[model samples]
Target: MIDYIMQYQSEIWQAIGETFVMVAISIVAAILVGLPVGTVLFLCRKGQLYENRVVFGTLNIVVNVVRSFPFLLLVVFLIPFTRFVVGTALGTLAASIPLAVMAIAYYSRLVEQSLLEVPRGVIEAATSMGASTIQLITKFLYVEARSGLMLGMTTSTISFISYSTVMGIVGGGGIGDFAIRYGYQRFETELMVVTIIIMIILVQTIQYTGSLISRMLDKR
Candidate 1:
């Protein structure tokens, strides 16, 4: 146990950094693209501030279609696109390509759903006050949905972490790869236990931190 860690310390650390790169890039990208995509989705719904059935149906179908794809299949499905984008079908960076696409679809729906939970009266009041479509979306809808948005982000990010584990099958480097290589392949039980603990700790920390931040943003 200790011997392996001591022997491959640099390799393990490199894998950790690789995993972080994949997850971090994917999460930030999801937030940037998902938030607006979701906002537009909600705004286009029938009877909303920016109602447009055409736009609503288009975005709705797109998001739903993307979300409905099985993630593993989605990754493999996107391989040619990924190769075009990242210039390769393997490694941490290449792995992020699929994660970002999946995250965008997954989180966009969550964001739209969260924004929908804002009371209708608040939206009506904003509209009555001459709030433009953009104003209503950015100020009222988002403000009301802030907590849910945070929780949704936390949830999606954690899911991405889990997804990264499977990326290793494609040679995407990460802690999961480490566990699989050292623990499963080499029959190193202690190494597997340690990696499992690390994953648990990482997940718990993300959950607690997300809760604290969401609470701070919530006045009610």
Candidate 2:
């Protein structure tokens, strides 16, 4: 294993870098796009301030459909759209299209759930104070739900890393792709074990950090 690591140190690093790139894009998509869509979903739900069954139903279906697809099939399903967006459906960058989509769907649902946990009284208090819609959400809703949101983001990011592994199917090279080519396909069992260990460590670290932060942010 050590010998293999020494021999492929550069390749391993490069693959790790590619994984970071894909995961980073997914994180950005989840934050910029997913977070807002989720906020909208929460606000537009039945009996909420912006209640609109039409809008909620449409977005709900879209989110559900995207989430329902197996990640691999989702990759295949998004080929044309990915190609159109990135000019090719192969490579680290192209893989981001589907990753972003999945991240949005997955995280939005979590975000909505997180927001649901916020105390109703907080919202009512803001309303009584004549807070505008923006003020209510930013000051009361998000402030109260920030911890849940952080934890949700942490969970989504870890899934993003896992999802990135399969992007290698479309020539999107990453640590998983390297493992496939050098470890599994090439019968380098030790190298495969090493990659698995790395992934486990990465996940454990992220989970611990997220949980710690969530606890710190929780007032109750």
Clash count of each predicted structure: 0, 0
lDDT of 2 by residue, 32-122 (tens): 9999889999999998889999999999999999999999999999999999999999999998999999999999999999999998899
Which run of 10 residues does model 2 get worst, by summed lDDT? Answer: 194-203
For candidate 2, the per-residue lDDT at 76 reads: 95
> TM-score for each prediction?
0.94, 0.97
lDDT of 1 by residue, 13-77 (tens): 88878888988988887889988999889888987877999998998898888888988898899
**Overall lDDT per candidate, in order of appearance:** 0.87, 0.93
* Candidate 1 TM-score to native: 0.94
Give the top-scoring candidate (lDDT): 2
> TM-score of predicted model 2?
0.97
